[model samples]
Target chain A: MQTIQTIIGYLYYAIAAVIGIVIVANFVRSRDVRKMLLYAIVLSPFVLRVLRVK
Target chain B: MADSKGNSLVIKIVVVALWLALIIPGGRQLAAHRNYEEAVVLGPGVTEVKKLSDWAPYVANTPNDCSIYVLDSGVPGGSMLVIGGTHPEEPAGVLSAVTIVENVVPTTGKIYVAVRANRSASTVTRPGDAYPQFFNINTDFGKRTFRMGDRWSNPLDSWPDPEVYVHYPSKQLLAYMDVRNLNRTWPGRPDGMITERTTRAFIDMIKAENIDIFVDNHEAELEYSVISTIVAHQAAADVAAMASMMLSAGEFNMGMEFSPTLLHGLSHREVGDHTDAYAFEIEVPEPFLDRVRGITDEALLLEGKDEFVMRAGQAGLLYEKIDENGWNIHERVGRTNSTIDMIVQMFAMFYPDKPITYESLPMRNDIVANGLGHYLLDPAQAEADRVVYE
Candidate 1:
């Protein structure tokens, strides 16, 4: 059960990574300043999580 | 077209800079709080300090493997276990346990105090709620700081909360986040989540050590009906009722209630049902937790004063009364300490054979007078070996 929990935890990180990648891709290609600002705001959590800061 | 491209590039740079500006300090503060450790000075009463993993190995190498300070008088009587930090947001609960660890000397039987019963919960604060990462109490020596934690275990420790929490053994469905709540995971299973495993570890210790009385300390918002009360399991109802009566009649206003039979996960219910020990939970008022609270800062957390909460009281929407004085930390901790002292006395009175007695615990009047910090010993003055970090 512990092992399963650990696996699920990693799965969550993987999901977050995928979401981060999608957000980054959109952030890079989008030309709208407002949308870019929104993407950056949304992407901050992913950045922090990746850095293991929070 | 060139101007448009340059403008887009500038906007992107600004966006990136803004992201950095936000995450840099925010992330650093969170990280610092996560890693911060509070110091505990082992008083003369502390005979030995054992890890929770000593009783239950499932919690070994985990964040919830908290310290259990054993204060044994060596006299044959009864044993009691008092645990705090079950809901880490309740500072009074944690401080009350710390007071016990640093002051109380057992005269009969034994006393086991866990200042951080759910150590994993203490590692994080509620960012959405704007909870402070730490709070300091002005001690005689200087200041003693402690982590201001949340109600649930850190997501880093227990990740991917289920959509709905199905409590083990009882199969009662609860809110998803309660799976990480220590109070909601009583008599917990070893193979469960970190909080569940933490409670299970404590239960194992209780059984191993033959604890006769079990006390779980907590503080509730004025909006919560359980404030300034003792919720006792049926097994402990008599002692709790007597203690409440004595306290209300003499020291202060303290009510008593029985733990609902249907409440499957609560300490007052599960601990009594699962173990031989009588279980009781004490709750004091905390204005900081009120939905009608004002500024969410360390001052409100410790001072427990909020005009909004007082206004709520004026509207008669609160179970406990709040005034300009509010429910300060010293009062809350003092109330908790006094309640525990009353419970001990009542337990001893009821069961003469299993008597648990202790001395030097600052009572309600003493704490309300001199302040909570007066009881806290200075680690700097203590020997190097006498201090322990929680």
Candidate 2:
């Protein structure tokens, strides 16, 4: 169970990083800070899971 | 566009900050649980202290490793081992062992105590039970807090229980969760799970110390038939019976029963079978442990009072007696201590050559007069070298 939980946790982080990367790229090219920033908000759970302080 | 951009960045930062708010507090709580320590003030009787790893190397650096306080008399006599925390939910056992460690002054033989027999189990509370994170005892210095732990070994230390936990040698099927129940893992295998290894380590220490008597302290729910009883291995039957009679005559209504030969993986049965020591396990009534308990809080744990439990008792569903006064922690711990004193005396009587005598530990009335906290020494007042943490 712990192993499975760890795997799922890492998966969450992976998806969050992907979303964060796409948002950063769009923000750099289109300079549409609003859209990119809203998308970046989705990355909070991923970053927190990665940190695993909880 | 500028307003939209400002809103988006503000929202993103707010979301992240919100998560950070929750994460930091939650993380601190988890860390606090893991880092919580109970201080032990060395009693006037303590002559030496040894780590569990000194006997069994497998648990050397592990969280399961614990202290073994030796109260030696210098006078030649047999040694005895008293263990607590086998089931951390039973606070009486832990408190009784601590009282013995902090108050007993051996006059004949040595008395070895392992207050946190399963140290790893002490680090976690029962998640769904809503039990308090800690319970405090009022002392002269202030309040001394102790972690309220669960019955099973912490999953952080041992996880992913088998679908069917087959007892190693007996091969009897038990609940998968029993794999982590220290009481269910006995005469433990050296290479088995962490809990097993922890018990096995104690066995090694028991043998090396040439202990004559082995005691395991515990508290049972009033609903259980085993409550208020002294369970003895076949070898220690006489001593336990005598001890039970002695206690009942003056102290409390403690019964004596022999450990069933068919029962496997228990301290009384396994410790006696696996070692030369005469094994005995004592149980006191703890109303809070009953299924019908109400308000499972620190008050319930300490006072052992629950209207629901009393109701069950009135209905003839409880094996032990219960009333409005209830069975408080002081009563439970006092009973355990007096029982231990009786067992030691009886064991000494039968085997004069290996007498283990100790003095100054409180009994029932004394504990009632001055709560469990009175016997607990203040770490602040103790010498720096005499203070240890569990």
Candidate 3:
């Protein structure tokens, strides 16, 4: 159970980092779409957790 | 296009979930710590321990009910009242008074120490500020836990602030939320708000006990101009000046300023004007209270180090100095304790008839060396009758 939890934690961080990089890249590329992407990235985890999709 | 839209929605949902996961538990942890309690070890000098309600019965059984520790020198010359926790978030005030109760042994005059002047405020933490619920200081026996309190009395204790707070007697209009500020409710009314009644009770205690000097302990943000200064009422200006000069020469840097005459509800002003006792308030610099503080946690609260606050100090925006060493808890408490000692000594010199004397209180150098926790006695080791909780 502990090993499983550790693996899950690493996966979570990896996903978060990837999402963060994507949002930042979008922000540098297009100003108009940046806010939308940032908002989506910021809010996505909560929507997933609330819907029990994870 | 549809796939992209779907993906954006999924991302938004995931981010929101992560935010909630962090926030919900973080808030709970903070709330859990808020209930920390500090034990007050009645020292050798404590002759009696009483409740605030004993002076004013109206506050009995209420959350505002606080403890009053009396240290009487058998050969008493004068009586002094030291109030702490007026704004509970200012831990130095409360800690200094607690140190006195735990260490001081009056040899000439009587001393009354109130560790929690506003008990209700100490029970609650500031909202949205992310203030730690509790902090601990290491001691010989073990660590002592103290609640990280709020500036105002908890709304749970006093609800629905008035649209405009009209101070009693003076009828001066103040901010609505100030009704919960004990400092602004000085010379309090018995039939008025809880904070007002608490102050009223203190006034009653002062008058009944014939207190010669009333000292209110406080700490100010580095941004505030009055940091590391003694604000004296008109009557106590001479004593304050003498104390300030002596402290500046002998110990730490300190200044004396007259309390604003027009400032209503403040203890330094109202307590002096209404009562016979000379009133003064001492303020030490606490960088943790600054707006530009980085992390609002126990480490910053105890160590007083914050990068953002230091940056502000570097820019010359702060009235007080701040560095990596920061303004640690010991320094703040040491300044307050030393100032109190200086004030009492000065008062004794000025009015030889009303001489208040006490010893065994650690001075600035001693406190800075030994740390504030060194002066604090472990309540668990104290006699059951001598242990009190604040």
Candidate 4:
């Protein structure tokens, strides 16, 4: 059960990471950056996870 | 003036006035919590004081930034960190940290104490549950009052918990409200919410200071299976085993358990997994936390007695022992202080070069006999520079 839960947990983070990448990409493609800061806040947890800070 | 239209307009004004009168007083009382601060007197052993922002810039100017009281003995030795008020509802942890800062004098190593790790959480109370806004302890100087707090950080500071709170890195699903629970947000993110940022600041401080052992103080409900035990990481098993054994044999009865490998976001789990520092979480019983508790007021919080909880114990539902004597706040705080001392003592046996040594701290027996208020120093007598407000 622990292994199964871990697998699902990883999947969840992966999906979140994909969403975060898309947000950054949208900011880069669009030149309008008013909401970029809020978008960055949404991506922080996932980015920190990938960097192994958490 | 006596026309129907005039009468209707007058009635409307009177209704609005009544509504404002009813709402303004209650709103003012709740808002006053933000201004409430508990004074902490610097003990003789304290060498320096730093804010959480000194380590993490992201937490600067935020409500979660907390005071880190450092008691250095000059002689080089090991270091230990003690954090309190991770869940502000657990008053024992907060009181224990304050007692350490106000009385303890280390002789060999250094100690870092944070009286309220989640300062934002301490600014709100569960008034819906009939919790008192503040609790007072009778001291030699006068009554020392402390703000009663909730388990989660105030929504004002960290608003809008996620619908399905996911643990960072692990992504483990948790209760939505737990997003603000400092205890469940260990080793957090630099750009995360306020509670997470507070934890991230703490992790940076721990690694930068080269902390040997990290201790997180907490109080658990009597019904919780983990009560009266020291939850240690795998790396600290040997130290925890000896400490618990030594304490149980002569002093208070204590047990040790290893952190569950799968439990994410817990200090005992994440701190150990993320850093070289061994993590240990101490749990003392607080009857006021029990689901079957009575009154749910300041008296029940301090006295730790409730007929409902006793009844639950009688039915063989509680994991810890209970009786008419009841576990009071003094006993809870003393247990935390003594347990940390025991852990440091056992750690010294294994690593003498980095021995963590401290003296003049109130032990379980001392607090039980003298009461928790005996150790609280008078804020007025304290030098302005030596005092910090939580």
Candidate 5:
């Protein structure tokens, strides 16, 4: 049960990190200025979540 | 580009899951801490514990019914009533009253303290502000939890606000929702709204007990012109002036202003007009209540530090100063306690025939040094009969 719980937690984190990276990459690759800005704003909370020290 | 659509779908699913994961825990934590209760340890000075209903039976078995703590000196001279939590969001007021109830030892006259003046308000939180449900004050025993309450009576208790609230007796028009505000329903009607009934019960208590001085504790938004001042009724102008002068010399800079005669519902105006007891309302600066405040949370509520509010202060928008050190809970509570002491002293001096004296109340410097928690007692360790909930 403990191992299963640990595996589930790791899987959740991995999925979240991958999605965050993809979102950031998409924002960087976007040609339309408005779309890029929108994506950047959308991804800001994730960046804040990752960078939060406390 | 071909695989982008599939990838986007996967990412969207993951993001939603992550959002849910974050929200569920946060929501559960908030729910768990929502209904916080503070313990009031009856100190050596406390003679008896009574309910608001005991004085006026109209509020009996109601959520608005509050605890009345009596610190009676056997050799009596005069009695004073200290009301706290009329607006529960102004926590410093309530905490100061609790500190007095748990620490003060009256030597000459009696002190009546209502820690949660608007008990119904304490059960609810400010909507859409993301206000923390509870705040903890560290004490000798452990963390003492207190409810983070709203300014007005909870909607669950009082609802369906009139299109325009006309002040009873005076018939002055006020904002509709202010009907639920305990502060605005002062010198209230017995058969009116819940807030009005509560205030009526208080007035009854005052008249029945022959309270000499009535001190209403409050905190004001920094943007308000009345911030960091005492509003005293005409009858209590001399006492307020003397107290303000003495307090300014001894402690913090405090000013006194006469309550507006036209203001119908306010305690400073109505209580004095209706009753013989002198009424004075103290306003401490609270940055959290300011419109320009950033991130309304427990840390900001307790420590009172807000960069946005500080920026507003720099722009000359605030009535009171705000900086990094901020207006801390300790400082606000200290100012209030000291003001109360000064007011009581002034009252005693002005009306020597009706004297109210007390000792062992932690002073401004002491509260600032040791913090508010240092003065509060642990109710768990107190005698079973002595521990009463507000």
Candidate 6:
């Protein structure tokens, strides 16, 4: 059971990492200022979570 | 073309810088709060300090494997267990238990106190509630700061909350986040979430220690109906009622209520049903938790003073009364301590054979007069071995 929970925890972090990568890619590609700002706001949490900062 | 490219580069740098500005300090603060430890000076009565995992192995490596302070008299009598920080937002409860650990010594039977019953909850403050990460109390030596925490266990410790929480055994549905609420996860399962396992560890300890009286301390918002009362299980209703009556007649206003039978996840209900112990929960008023509260900060948290809460009382919207004095930390902790004292006194009267007696604990009036800080011992002055971190 502990093993399963650990796996699930890692999976959540992996999902965050994936989302962060996607956001960064989109952020760099997007030319719209409003869209870039929105992406930055959305990406901040994922970045922190992936980094295990929060 | 050159100007357009330059503008794009500048915008990218600005966006990145903004993101860094948002997360850098916030992340650092969160990390510091998570890692900070509160100091506790073990009193003369503390014979041993055991980990919660000592009784239940399932919580051995978890964040909720909190310390259990055992104070045994060696004389044969009844045993009691008092737990605080079941809801970490309630600072008074934690401080009350700390006072017990630092000051009280049982004369007969044994006593076990958990100053931070739900340690994981104490690690994080409520998000977006603007809760102060910590609050400080002045002591004779200097000041002692304690983490001001959230009601539920940190999501970092127990994440991916279920869409709905179906309580074990009873199958009662609770709000999803309550799965991480220590109070709501009583009679917990070993294989369940971290919070559930923590409670299970406590329940195991209760059984192992042969705890005769079980007390869980808490504080509630003035608007909440359960404030300033002792909510007891039917097994402990008589003791609670007598204590409430006596305290109100003598020390302060206190009410008694029966734990609702249908309330599936509460400590007062579940712990009593599952164990031999008579379970009682004491709640004092905390204006900081009220929806009508002003400025969410340490001053409001400790002083419990707020004009907005007073206005709510004026409108008769509050279940508990408050004035300019409000319900300070000292009052809340003192009342809780007194209630615990009264409950044990009444319990002994009903069952002379299982008498749990203790001494040197400051009562409500003493605390109110001299102040709560007077009771808190300076760790710096204490012997190195006598100090423990919670």
Evaluated against the true structure, the overall lDDT of model 5 is 0.83
Cα RMSD (Å) per model? 1.3, 5.4, 11.0, 11.0, 11.1, 1.3
Model 5 has how many clashing residue pairs? 0
Model 4 stretches astray by more than 4 angstroms: A1-54, B1-8
User: Candidate 1's residue-wise lDDT over B175-240, tens digit each?
Assistant: 999999998998899998898898888888989998999999999988988879999999999999
Q: Please, what is the TM-score per model?
A: 0.97, 0.86, 0.82, 0.86, 0.81, 0.97
Docking class of 5: incorrect
Worst 10 residues of 4 chain B by lDDT: B11-20
TM-score of chain B of each: 0.98, 0.95, 0.92, 0.97, 0.92, 0.98
The residue ranges of model 1 lying beyond 4 angstroms of the native Cα positions read: B1-6
Q: Which stretch of 10 consecutive residues in model 1 chain B shows the poorest summed lDDT?
A: B35-44
Candidates 1 and 3: which is better by lDDT? 1
Q: Which pairs, if any, clash in model 6?
A: none
Worst 10 residues of 2 chain A by lDDT: A45-54
The list of candidate 2 runs beyond 4 A from truth reads A1-54, B1-20
List candidate 5 stretches off by more than 4 Å. Answer: A1-54, B1-35
The Cα RMSD in angstroms, rounded to one decimal, for candidate 2 relative to the true structure is: 5.4
lDDT for B123 in candidate 6 is 91
Worst 10 residues of 3 chain B by lDDT: B27-36
lDDT tens digits, residue span B123-220, model 6: 98966888999999987778998988999998888877888998877999999999999989988899998988888888889888889999999999
Query: Candidate 1, after superposition: displacement of residue B14 in Å?
Result: 2.6
Q: Is 3 or 5 the stronger prediction by DockQ? A: 3
| lDDT by residue (tens digit), candidate 4, B217-326 | 99999889998999999999999999999989988888999999988888888888888787999999999999998888888999988899999999999999889878
Best by DockQ: 1
What's the distance in Å from true for residue A51, model 6? 3.0
State the lDDT at B59 in candidate 5.
86
lDDT at B47 for candidate 1?
96
